[model samples]
Target: MRRLPLLLLPLALAACNGGTGTPVTIDVKSDDGDNGSFRMENGTVSIKGDGFQGNFRVPQIKMKADDVDLDGVKLYPKSEIAGFHITGGDKPGNGKDGGKDGSKGGGKDDGKVRIDFTSPASLAAVQNWFRDGFTKKGFTFASRGDGFAGTTSDGGTFTLDLSADGGQKVKGRMEMTGS
Candidate 1:
C-alpha cells in the first residue's frame, strides 16, 4: 500500500505536465480581393496563468492580404499588461493602451469600424466585416504603427487601431481624417 502511493505520485505529476495547450493565431486579410501579404516579425506576449505565469515569443508571422503588402509589420511589448479583457461590436472605451476611441454609427463618416473578440470565431467574424466593410465603402488601407491608415475610395483618410488584452478582450479605434 505504501509503495502504491509512491508509484502514483510520478503519474500524477506527468498528467499535470502534459503538453496539450492550444496555441492562438491571428490572421489578417484585405477586403478588395487584392493580392498582398502581411507579416509579423519578432514579437512577445505574456500570458497570466493560474498561480503560475508564462510568456511566448513569436519570431515571425505571415498574413495574406488582398491588396497591400504588410510583410514588415511587427508587435512587441510596450509595457507590462495585466488583467486583459476582450469585447466586440461598437464598444465605448478605447483598448487597454488607451490609444483610440471607437465610433458607433455606421456610415461614410464612420470611416473605421472596430470589432472585439477573443476566440477564433469572433476574430473571423471581424475579419469578414473588414472585408465587406471596406469593400462596400471602397477604401484602400495600409498598416501604420500598431494600427492601420489609408484613404477611402471616396477620398477620405482613416485610422484604425486594435488591441488585445491577453486573449481576454479586444478594443478598436475608428478616427476620421479630420477632427
Candidate 2:
C-alpha cells in the first residue's frame, strides 16, 4: 500500500507538470495603410506566455497625410484577449517630401486607438466596428476576398484581412498604401 501511494505521487506530479499545455506564441508583421510609395517597417507583435496578454511594437512607420513617423508603438492586451490598447506617438518627418519649401509641413501628433477583437466569433463585430468607425469618419469597405480594400476619409486606400487556421488563434492583417 505504501509503495502504491509513492508511485501515484510521482504520477500526479508528472500530470501537474506535463509541460504539454505550455502557451504558444505567434509573431505577426502588419502594415498600417499610410502611403504606398513609402514603406512602413519594424512592425511586430508578441503574445505573452499566458496567451491572454500581448505586446505590439512598431519601431518605425511613415505616412504622407500627417507626415507621421511612428517609433516603438506599443500595444497591450485588454479585456478581450483579441482586443488591444495601443499607446505611443509619432516620429518626426514628412512623407516622400521632407519638410521643405514645397514639401508638406510637419508637426507633432499624439493619440491612442482601441483595436477591437477580430476572431471567428468577432468577425461580424469587427466588420461593424470598422464600418461604423471608418464610415462615420468618411470611409468605406470595398469588396475583397475574406477582407476589404477601401479608402479612408483622408483618401488613403487599404486592405484588411482576418484569418483563422481553425484554431484558438486568429490573426488580422491590415495593409495601407498611398493610392
Candidate 3:
C-alpha cells in the first residue's frame, strides 16, 4: 500500500502542472538606494533617480513567461503606466574612470541596449508609439521604419530602430549621441 501511494504521487503532481498556467501580471520593484524606485509590471517598466524620472511601455504581445530585467540595469525609478517601458543605464560599473592601465575603467561610451519584445501593436504601431511620445516631449525627428532618427529637446542627437514583420513583435533600440 505504501509503494502504491508513492508511485501515484508523481502522476498527481504532474496533473496539477500539465498545461500552460494562467497568464498573470507580475510586479517587480528595485531600490535606487536613495529614496528612488524601479518597478516593472508585465510588459511595462519605469524608473526614477536624483535628477530624472521616466516612464516607458512596450507592446504587450503574446510571449512565454520570461524575465526581462535587462541584467539589472538599475534605471527604472518610480511611476506607473501601461504598454511600454525601457530602463537601463548605470550608477557605477566595471567601466570605471580611474583604474590601473589595463584594469577596466569607467566606459567613455554612453550606455545602450537592443529592446526586442512582443507587442499586440504592429510594426507600424510600435513605430508610432515612439514617434508620438518623442514629438509630444519636444523631440523633433525624421521618421523611419517604426521609430525616429532625430534630436532630443536639449539638442542630443537621437536614434531609434525598429525591426519586425508587418504585424509582428518589435525589435528596437533607442540611443542618444552622448549622455
Worst 10 residues of 3 by lDDT: 72-81
Between prediction 1 and prediction 3, the one with superior lDDT is: 3
TM-score of each: 0.28, 0.34, 0.36
Over the stretch 68-121, how does candidate 1's per-residue lDDT look in tens digits? 211222112121111112211212232233223444423322223222222222
Cα lDDT of all candidates, in order? Answer: 0.34, 0.36, 0.42
After superposition on all C-alphas, the RMSD of every candidate to the true structure, in Å, is 19.4, 18.6, 16.6
The CA lDDT at 115 in model 3 is 35
Clashing residue pairs in candidate 1 (N, C-alpha, C atoms within 3 angstroms):
34-66, 35-66, 38-70, 85-168, 85-169, 86-168, 86-169, 86-170
Number of the top-ranking candidate, with TM-score as the measure: 3
**lDDT by residue for model 2 (64-151), tens:** 2111111211111221223323332323343344333454636433323223333444455545545555556667667576656777
Better of 1 and 2 by TM-score: 2
**How much is 127 displaced in model 2, in angstroms?**
2.0
